[model samples]
Target chain A: MKKLFAMLTVIALMLGLLAGCASDPKPTKPAGTQGTQAPTGGSGGTAGSEGPSEDKAPIRVGVLAPLTGTMAEFGKTYEVAMSMAAEKVNAEGGINGHELVLEFEDSKGDQNQSAELASKFADDDGIVAILGDFSSGCAMAAAPICDEEEIVLFSPTASNAAFAASSKWAFQIAGLASYEGSYAATYEVGKYAGAHDVAVFYMNTDFGASIVENFRPAAEEAGMNIVFCEGYSDTETDFSALITKAQAANPDHVLIVDQTSISNVINQIRGIGWDVPITMLGPSTSQQVIDLCGENCEDILTTVSVYYSEEDPEAYAFAQEFADRAGFGATVMAGFAYDGVIILSEAIAACGDNITRAAIRDNLAKTDGTYLTGPIKFSEDGDIIRSYLICQIVDGKYVIRCGYDYANE
Target chain B: MSKIKAFVGKHRSLMLTAALVFAIVFPLFGFKKSMVRIFCRILMYFTLAGSLNITNGYSGQTSLGHAGFYCIGAYVMAILTTRFQISFWPVLLLSGIGAAVAGLIISVPTLRLKGIYLSIITLGASEVIRIIALNWEGVTGGSFGIKDIPRPTFFGFTFDSPLKFYYLFLGVAVIFLLISYRLIHSRVGRSWMSIRENELAAKSLGVRTAPAKMMNFAYGAFWAGIIGGIYAVYVQYIDSAVFSLDEGFNIMSMIIIGGQGTLIGPIVGSIVVNGLTELLRPIGVWRFVMYAALIIVMMWFRPQGLMGESNSILAGAKIKMRKAGKTGGKKEAIS
Candidate 1:
């Protein structure tokens, strides 16, 4: 009886394992099959069936997104926006008559997992290009593997200066933090806010450090004084100590550089009833900041490369579709992710019928077209120099204070 | 099952040879490159868990700050190789020595502490090391971490691919096992085990428990440091985030599940834990839940661990009953 019970337990565990594997959506299978299936059986079926691209094999692109960890929100944005882009491409009669399929594997925001998944993607012969791995650290971890494997790793949000230059195969759509930092210091703080003495509180990561390092020299050149500069760890929640220190400096303005924790810093600063003018470099046009900060976020200055306003109908349409799918209003990250897919597809489409990884990378380097974000042109280092839009939170909404050409002004 | 165990026990050397041969030729099976990477991870963790077992199992030190030694080794390799362009082979040894020295330093202050108190100190030490790695931006590169670490090469052959790394890790794991086997049979090994069995009795038996414990910690830390150096080159990146307190727990979990106090236990633990990680990848965050459940089940059914010594004091069963029986016998004799 004891042996039988043990055997039963083993069987149950095996069944659970099998169930787990079965539940996971396999990468090889076309994700749009269900949507395409109904159309194929209908009036649209005739055109799709008759098209020469129908019989050709689909071009599969692997995506390394942190689907289940701390960065799941950003990863989900990639999944939704990219899938939306793929669906639109398929609707407009696939890439050069070949179906564009994306196989997303979760990296869980861990660099080790990112590297391993990048390797797995590189191993697969069918996958022509790869996308994502979210944060700069994870993207950098996967950079060496992608470089060694001779495959393109296109990230939507990695903004570290060293990332794109780490490997020729690594390409990031997000503008470097250095550029954004300088722009924030010169244009936003130095010119717009006119705050001479500023205190900076940044996250102690690659993204945060790069901004502050660049912001300092620019801030000084713009005749602005950095009264206090400090960095807090990512997991930091209680900002009372840092706030207290910054308050001691008594600067006219405070600049917070972070993504997810921007709202927390604002809340803590406002929670202590310190009403100093606050400007943020990261978390560009993020709705969460306004939503979380409520009335405290009034007149909070930030910057963005692209703002999905109703002024641009095309971008507005994309944002609406993303909102419908993602259940959250579209942010600049979602736009970048959307542009990442469109731009990669354009590169793959430029390859014509002979689509190899090398061909895709070469064509991608030559990308000079305007994307959902802005006019994107990769420099020799495989990253773009993007112009910024100075935005301010007025009555809990991101109102554009300056256009993309504000730097020129 | 009993018959198979008996046959394996009778022909231990033969089984061992067969297993070793299989491991050596396993990568040649034309598996996917990612599968080879997983095998490399298992081999790496095997050495790491084995080293932790030396302190926690043999000497009963329960050092929870193993990641501190690991972080030291990784940073040593990263700084030397990236900054100075030092050769990988010498830096590898240097990394181990660095960690072993750190372990000795940590063990000195906590020589009198035991059980929970010692565990807490180790945990705190691990965090202190990580925080330093995070803040000391000049040497450690702070949160940016040391990236683009050049791969190790042997006589113009680069260990770049996962397949090449598999062999490097395999060679290290085998050497670790062989050395540990010999050391565990030596007088020093016996003294450490005696300390684990009963520290006071070992002291009365003229065994210097303090030095024995210190040596055990250094030996364990040395191997962890070696593995950390290899890992730095393997990932080609070293960061403070990688050596978290959770990582220390991860190594400890492998030991607990695989069975501590035995040479084969760590090897088994590495395989099972890594294998499960791959198998449960599709389950997303639930995989952690599954890991916790497995550990709990292990504790309930086999507290000493799967291959742990059942008769040893670490088992906490027969030894307690024997102590009670001895006390009762003394009372009867007095009556």
Candidate 2:
């Protein structure tokens, strides 16, 4: 009995000790918990006079990007831009005294991860808008969630035209592939005189197909004949077969919209030695493309939102600020991301304390901005009515050909 | 009452209290949305791992098609809730039952095989399920996945809130733990141990090995289905992405690292693996390398697991035993 008592006592003590030791060893809370520090308590310094509480809280916007992934270069740059916009907004006495807060969540380049991150953002009870998901797939997955919950989404670069028609909630800020295709067609017909045969080699996905579909119609309209339209899947690394087809077509120039398999495609194109002219589209036209293609990248024509030539004083100023913070050249993605946040800032300003999803949506619909991207507007379909800048590789860089606005054209 | 008697009598209540405290207080330690999301995930994987422990650990069957059952449950619940607009509770229950039925069917054929052969067949079964989920684009959303499967709801309250969802999960987990405990203590559990010890001997003792094994598989798969259903609702989405070969590997890793036959082992293993993944994100992609290394080390040093075959209660007693042993010796000399 004594032994049993002793045994029980000892066990009890040990159990208690273990429980104490095991009780939730929380990691030290990082001072800045990324997205939690929203401007608290609506603007009122006048001694406790009960005014509408709606006049106080900042508009909480979520910036969902691959803070970490294959697209982290663009994602991290967007973060830097968004951060600058927030800093600028807050510094300028805030929007009607309602400061803008951008909470950054790393979507980790997975649709499931993006969905979960969006859900988390929605749960914060403060978020009026969300900007993200550089990839169309991630954006596509997340759009419904935001839609169902009624959160305004201003995607920086999920430019799949299919998404434009998918949801009212999906408002893409960059030019869609259809727009890119039309631009490519206009450029090819105007420059190459519509007599030379054009070959289209695009990635085998909805993104690639949308652009290709647009290309055929516009090319035909411009009287430019397609020599051969070949599709390549993401798995096609060598691209020997596709390039061989392009060369066999005997085309003066080829418009290639595939970058799912990068650098290798450029090398394959160079290997074909069909050096009439080559044009590319989608988010793959940048310094990285230059780095990937090297000497092979010259004379390659691509359409972008804007070039960072430090030309437009507003763009140059923003680019300098971005470079100072992000430690990289301000690419189109960074510019769009900057505009995405600044647009939110402007919208929030327009809405004042009524920064609900409806209000944000209304404000976005009403937006007419001379942003860094040039004359940002939104179509009824929620596609950004932004200009497409034609870019050609010159002296190992993306030189601006000319800017053409969709709204104007 | 004597202290020993009192402690023994109060054991269940004490455990209940401890669990309640742990569940309630856990979220308060900084409800980082990521952490909350991870907590929901931990509850999910824990449920799956615990269910897995019933067949693979207790019954000593190396069934690799647990993910198939999991996927079936997920897809069923997702399709029912999202498409048919079924209520969350019924969908969850029906999905679990559906998965259990599927498990029984799969078990009938594969139970005849033993060891690696069974594992291989079960793996094939899981892969087949994955392929179906991928190709059945009209239903399963192909690689694109189904989105916004409604969050769990009960009575007038909706579990749309993470905090509410967390509590709902805790309730379900507690129920599962109770069910698992009751099942483990039953005569069927003893029969399972007999079969695990020596199937031939168990057969000699009129154990009806086929039915018994089928029962284990069914029960194991039922819980897996429940986890899947809850997962569909909790994540509010279901697709081939949620149910993949990698997920199968993750469940397998949980069972291996947590200690195959032990009850508490699966929970510990889930936390260790999942927690490490979240905590070691700073190490970037190499975190997977670190996790693999940790698992390898665990396998090398402690093949029987940290808790071995001992129940958590028994492990608690053993600690007491060692402490008493040390103190008693010292006291005797002093006396």
Candidate 3:
């Protein structure tokens, strides 16, 4: 009886494994068409298509996001914002009469998984383009595969200077770290805050390293001295020792470079009763920092590639809808993701009926228009350089202190 | 099923040849490039898990830091190949020797320890290696990692695609298995097994237990390092983040599920685990939960693993015999 039971269990497990593999790839439909009927000759339909038809095949794009690891927050943001963009595109008569579909594969923020998923997407004949893998390291890992496969590897927020340059098929929408870092050092720390000696605490990753590498030369050129610089691992949570070391330097200003742990650093700095002016380079206009740090975030300075203010109706609408879905205020990272989808769809629309991988690449390379994140034009290296807005946390909210043209002034 | 197992046991050599032929021609079946990559991953892990089995399975030494040795080999190849522009063929051997040396150094301190204590020391040692790699900016590139690692070439043919790299991994895996098979059947293998059965008994029998254990560790670490070098070139990128405690645990889990103290255990483990990874891709985060549940089930039903030696000390068969003897004594007394 025990032997028979064991055999039966083995059979059941084998069946479960087969069932898991047998299921078709799950592609997310446009959010607008999930429950409601398809629009027929409506106001949104007038932009491109005559009407939404069920017979036309949907254009699919594979999205590799780290939905289950340390970077899950950013991955979820990409999922929500990209789906929102797909919904908007479909509601506006789809991309050249074909409904836009997104197949989000969770990479868990691992470079191996990212590269494997990229290969899977590249092998599929249905998928025309690939988006995301979150970090620069993961994106760079997948870059070789996408380059060899001749498929478009478009990243929403890979700011590494070497990432886009690694592959001809690779393109990133995030402003280069070199440009952002220099602007932060020269403007935020040097000119705006009038701080001479700066202590920098950056994450130990490609993104953090590149920023500091560029920040040093720019800070020195601006006549500011770097008293101390240190990097901590991404998984590190305790900032007491790091903060103490930085405090020992007794710098006039402190700059923190990281996305997930900005609030932890700020709270720790204030917890130790050190009140040096803190300016951050990453985590642009994040409400989580304010929520987590509370009063400790007061008068904290930062730079953003884009800012959605109540004064702009279009940008404000996006912010409101994003907040309703994401359960937090929208940041510039979300803006980049939303813009990424729309930009890719526009390139797809330009392909007309003969849309191949090469055609998508050609059309995307020629992208030189205004986006949700302001004017975006890919340089020869396939990344963009955008102007910045100086933002300050006042009364527990992000308030823009300078316009996009602040660097020029 | 028993009949089939008996038949296979009778013609073991024939079955082995047939399986080897199938593996060699697998990529030529016109499978998708992604599928080929999955097979490559399986073969890579086959060697990795098999190496771990040398210490944890054969010698009864529990190690949870195989990834530290793996990290050493990968970094050795990446640094030498990228910076010095050395040929990959030589670096591959150097990487293995490097990891073997690291294993020997680690074994020195852990010679007197056993079970969980040795495991804890290995775990700490793995973290120390990763921390050093992360902070050593000059040679290791700090957190930026080493990138653009050149692909290995044989004469003029570059291992550029998944199909080509599949052969490289297969070649290494086959060589490892052949050498391990010879080693496991030799007198040295008998001494290692005796130590696993009882270190005190082995020592009384004039077997050098300490050197045997150290050599076993070095042998295991050597194979891990070789595979790590292959992995560095395969991915063309090396970073400190790749070799974490989680990675060490991942390799260990394969041995647990496939069965330890057996030659074919790791191969079976690799297929089941890597196959499940692809099959469960649609399930998202729940796949990890499923994997944990599968391990729990394996432990409950077959603690020695699928291919682990059932009669070995690691399987607790001696304890079962002792209990049965005690029960029989009680029955005789009652009679």
Candidate 4:
């Protein structure tokens, strides 16, 4: 038995050794030389082969997605969305006539792995730009490495302030959490006419503090009464006491100002048989929130910076196509990821033949106008200005209650 | 060939010296920078797993919370050096001591709670530590974390590049290895192992179980914290995010899968597990699934792991054959 165990150990160690040396060492190969388009029949297989793909090497974009762990589901959507973006560019004759290919690297939502992959992408000469990292933590982890190596690290969903503060090369398309909180407040006032009193049960943390601080002024300005306001610590998992306190004042609606704790508060409120309307201030914007809350999620109002509807033909088409490819509904994170690729490719194409990291950065810094998200532009700190939409959970699905009234649109 | 095998086995120091020379000259051969980074990562994990092996693998204590100590060490250095503009040289040992103090705080209370209960206490303590870091926005930077952690310096020269980091990690890892080697063969290590074998029996034999357990806990945590300090400087950023349950599990997996209680096993295991995980990253989300499958298969077939369980087929056979060879004086057949 010991001998067999020793043999297994040897086998496992060999596999590990193999994995260590498994990084791709291939030089940047010109597009249309192998696979996709132009067959080995001497470049006369397809008309599209006549493009610069035959002569120029394809631009490689490193995608740092949480492909395996808690964020694996998000990673799936991101993969489909990014590949969809890549395919769209390839169909449109590729970036600058040189094909664009995405090299996916899984961070597994770990800081260590994210940092390692960041260095790998930075070191790889083929990888001209980087996009992804599902969460803000993962993005910030890799930001310093990319910044040091002069590589552009663009994240569509890393909304943390730390990301921007980490490196000059780091760019996040997701609006800051503080901005999102304030914007949500403005959207709520616009939708509800500010006549009803508001009750807020917020988590006692920087994230929770920011939402209420921003929401208080907006709610007050809109002529809403501050009926009952409370803050709870993260360690206070039992929401019964907080729910009882919230039910006493009985404001027109209650805003659970939290991310992870929102769904808990929602479900607990349902257990008490109080059917007052609820709008989660921050967090629990994920699909899993509905899964957790079930029928209770209905009629719940929430504000989101990322608003995609079937009403918009372009969004509808992309959503439909993405669903067909991935066999799941396109998530908000996935939409941002799709837009992230387009933004990078757009900047690379704009660079012409002088497509360098600094050029990509400069081009991105000057970007403005509508793309996937309307009026997309980067501030000096590399954060995007978002026009938040007022949405309500209707029949287990999101329904827009008002237009994109943010930026007073 | 037979004579050569005997001679080589007798001159083990010569073999080790040659291997050490090979390792020292490896990065100088113009290896890829990315590969060098992976090597440094392996070395870092090597120290982490080796330290974990002290409390978990040797002492028979189940701790799922080394990450807390690791966090304490990193944050202590992050706060002291980055905040106070302190030098990195003394802080390295200070971080270890800081982690040791934290371990003492945990182990003293947890000494009464044996096995799984003790593990749970440690796990809860880790989460509590994380929550404290998350909420205390003033000192620890809260959830945003402390950035710009200065790297270790040597004689006015700062180690910045991957090559420099490789040597730094390697040297530190080697020092820890020597420490573990000496400690494991010492009287205290023997007492700890006896307690592991049977606490009631060791206690009956006049062994101070509490002191032994506490010493083991502190020693393990001390090294874990030192690695954490080095890690903070390596990444140049310290956050509450890094100290997750998954990281603790990852450290445990390194020792368990490689060969717990064996000095060489944890090193091999850390390299394999971390290397395989990193390599599998490009394969999409199935990498973790694959890794899990690998561990499940390993556990099923070899519960003692790669080098752990003694009395297994090869270990027992080698002992039997060696004893026979000694008595028979070259007359006994050896395979």
DockQ for the candidates, in order = 0.30, 0.12, 0.34, 0.37
Looking at model 4 chain A, which ten-residue stretch has the lowest summed lDDT? A36-45
Q: Once superposed on the true structure, which residue ranges of model 1 sit more than 4 Å away at CA?
A: A1-27, A32-53, B316-335
Instruction: Indicate the docking level reached by candidate 3.
Output: acceptable
The top-ranked prediction according to DockQ is 4
- Assess each prediction's global lDDT (C-alpha) against the native: 0.84, 0.70, 0.84, 0.76
Per-model chain A TM: 0.90, 0.80, 0.90, 0.81
TM-score of 4: 0.87
**Native-referenced Cα lDDT, model 4:** 0.76
Per-model B-chain TM-score: 0.94, 0.87, 0.94, 0.90
Query: Residue A262, candidate 1: how far off, in angstroms?
Result: 1.4
Q: Which stretch of 10 consecutive residues in model 4 chain B shows the poorest summed lDDT?
A: B326-335
Q: Candidates 1 and 4: which is better by TM-score?
A: 1
Tens digit of per-residue lDDT, candidate 2, span B176-231: 88887777778788677677777999999998888889999999999899888887
| TM-score to true structure, per model | 0.92, 0.68, 0.93, 0.87
lDDT of 1 by residue, A148-187 (tens): 8999999988988888998999999899888889999999
User: What fraction of the true interface does each of the listed models get right, in terms of native contacts kept?
Assistant: 0.33, 0.07, 0.34, 0.36
* DockQ versus reference, model 4: 0.37
**TM-score of chain B alone in model 1:** 0.94
Error of 3 at B251 (Å): 0.8
Best by TM-score: 3
- Per-residue C-alpha lDDT of model 2 across residues A1-409, encoded as one tens digit per residue: 3334434433453354334324323332221342322122211121122321335654567767776656666666766777766666666666677656566666766666787677666655666788887777788767766776777777877777655456677788777777677767866434433446888887755567667778888888877889898776555677888788678878877777865465678877786675667777746665667777788888777777676665677888888877776666677777888788778778777876566778878888788868877777878888864456677789887777665643245
The 10 consecutive residues of candidate 2 chain B with the worst lDDT sum are: B326-335
